[model samples]
Target: MSGAETEPGVLVLAATPIGRVADAPPRLAEELADADVVAAEDTRRLKRLTGELGVEVTGRVVSYFEGNEQRRTPALLGSLLAGERVLLVTDAGMPSVSDPGYRLVAAAVEAGVPVTAVPGPSAVLTALAVSGLPVDRFCFEGFLPRKAGERARRLAELASERRTMVFFEAPHRTEAALEAMAQAWGGERPAAVCRELTKTHEEVRRGPLAELVAWAADGVRGEVTLVVQGADDVPAVSTDDSSLRAAVAEREDRGMTRKEAIAEVAVLAGVPKREVYDLVHKSGPGEATP
Candidate 1:
């Protein structure tokens, strides 16, 4: 054989139901049954899903999640390089979208292994499709930072993003995330909060950010996905030092760092944040800023 190596095995990324088990696609069953090994974000959930789908998983199952993904990638790569068909699935949606499997996919690619996907249910696509927002052009932002300060900074950076944005948030933090969005993007921005998508209790609450925040005030539950309208082209606003300082101060009072505030103010005012930073610093620290 010319000493040429054989082609490596394939890595299959299978999408699981975001909520309703019925939404699981037909090809996923074949992949689960035929894969030489299966890496699941939650093995228990995998078992439950197989049972509900009336499918049997005959492959060796292993845990693969955010916590152990990096450490486990090498072993999975070994299996792939050894010509074993490995299938990856997450608790919900497709693997590697705010979930595990990215490492293994990357490793497999680097090793010249063929990688394929059995597209099925996805929380991101479902939310975006049903969001009634601008689907023509959109982006999935995954989850926002958990910490308040970090989350604020993240929102500020995206404040000027012209494409529609989607974010996943925990049930308990839905209210807070929406509140923060209202603060950063204005309350009147159109958005939809999709909860328990594809399930019996699935809900898609569509309205302005302010109204949604008030609705979520009492509490929100289940898998929460927020789809917010993108920023419209804003006419250049007055960039007087006093105005700039006040804008930065407003975000600061709300817990944003100076750098974060500058980035945000810069995007909003359509001016270079660096210029604002220099101007603000030139005014002296103690007199204008607190």
Candidate 2:
């Protein structure tokens, strides 16, 4: 009885539904009702969830989102130390997966507060489940960098990633992201775009990168998750400048014009125009222009 009287030092990081309220884990309602304090990414969303669960949040409620996590974590930690069972939840999915709650979790660990999760629906896994890709090994690359240059550099680095890659992007940026991926990962790479998983308008568009880019150009709305095929150990195509130029020069020898040859070789070798040109130029004056 004395042990039972002792305050709970556990920090609960609960997973919320990504969509469809009915999909929420059953344990969530009981946890919310039993917690001494609840830290939510959005209090209004929490309220809505509680309403749906028909569970009253007798605990004190506070906001703990990206904007206030740093400031809020310490306060929540203080509550835990005081023997309060402080629960952290995001608007959807697991907190800290491209969402808030990372700071609070770190703070709790430092403060020696025990932390556990009430695992629930996840957009990443949901998308991957329907992706039909090689998920035996996979990596989640949460939301790509927003800037075009940084995003391209990131994608270029991931070009050789051997595991399936999952990413989340806003509806508006879906097309641009797909296009950039096509440029970096080859247009033929297989991918899937999952939107509004488990919701009424749930959609999964699976195809080559080039086709996905074209599909996205028509505009996609709602939460978006992308699963891209990883680099297979297939032998690299000969796209070195000289190699491409040789192929292009061969095309030229066959009556194809310089512009036509460059474009054709660039497509065949799966490389950029500038890359093919450099190959041709480095071949030296006389050696170039077959």
Candidate 3:
């Protein structure tokens, strides 16, 4: 309890190397050596990392992983409340993104402990930079659902998502995820699959979802991040009653009943079902509003 006094408790979330240790930021070593407690996703990995960095950690070290996050966060926060600097580190990348640091961060923030980040190597941005997709407006979708049906349903929900999307996935499931994407977002939509980013064997494959599905069938290895193009803007439709009638009629031509066709068209067009019905039933042909 006598490490220091009158200093605010700071919770530092440090980002470690995703692959090559050489990529570690110099401040990471300084923080590890000086921190009062080092909470790591894997204590063994932390030990190895400290050995590589040649930093002597004088403070206590504890494991904070998925299995024990709920139990460990409070203990770490307790240390913070005692005016100790608790540094959080993961096996790779930043501490929180798809990692174990988020819960602790949330707790620390709620407890009024100052939270900061030692930003360093990041697989999300690394993959997105090399993905050659639109990065200006993109969303990070950490990981897709593991089950086949759930995964497909999740992708379907994003069918009309306008921003570029990013995802992290297991090597073995890459093909299946890409196949589902192709079926949901059209086979020709552009996408990129980045593998082993920032490592020696880093690979970036870019093309349509269908091509990626076929390519991944041969097998992929290492960590994977996927970036996908957004939906192209559709041609503007007349707000008149005729356009709605035509939309419904087109759906009915494909064997759907009037009600079923309206529902399907509304989904496909990303509009309300009630709006489609009103447009077809209320407004006549060319006089509809735009």
Q: What is the TM-score of each candidate against the true structure?
A: 0.87, 0.79, 0.81
Candidate 2, 1-290: lDDT as tens digits:
34554554789989999999999899999899999999998999999999988999999999998888898877888889888898889999998899998888888888778999999999999999999999899999999989887787677656657899999999999999999999877899999999999999999999999999999999999999999999886344486555666776765554445666666667657888777776776677677542
Alpha-carbon lDDT of model 2: 0.86
Model 3 Cα lDDT, one tens digit per residue, 128-231: 88888888898889899998766765675566578889999999999999998897778999999999988899899999999999999999999999999888
Q: How would the candidate models be sorted by lDDT, starting from the highest?
A: 1, 2, 3
Candidate 1 lDDT over 66-111, as tens digits, reads 9999999999999988889999999998899898978888888888
Predictions in order: lDDT = 0.88, 0.86, 0.85
RMSD of 2: 8.8
Question: Of the pair 1 and 3, which is ahead by lDDT?
Answer: 1
- Answer with 1 or 2, whichever has the higher lDDT: 1
| Superposition TM-score, candidate 2 onto the true structure | 0.79
Comparing 1 and 3 on TM-score, the stronger one: 1
Clashing pairs in 3: 240-288
Off by over 4 Å in 1: 1-4, 237-257, 260-281, 285-290
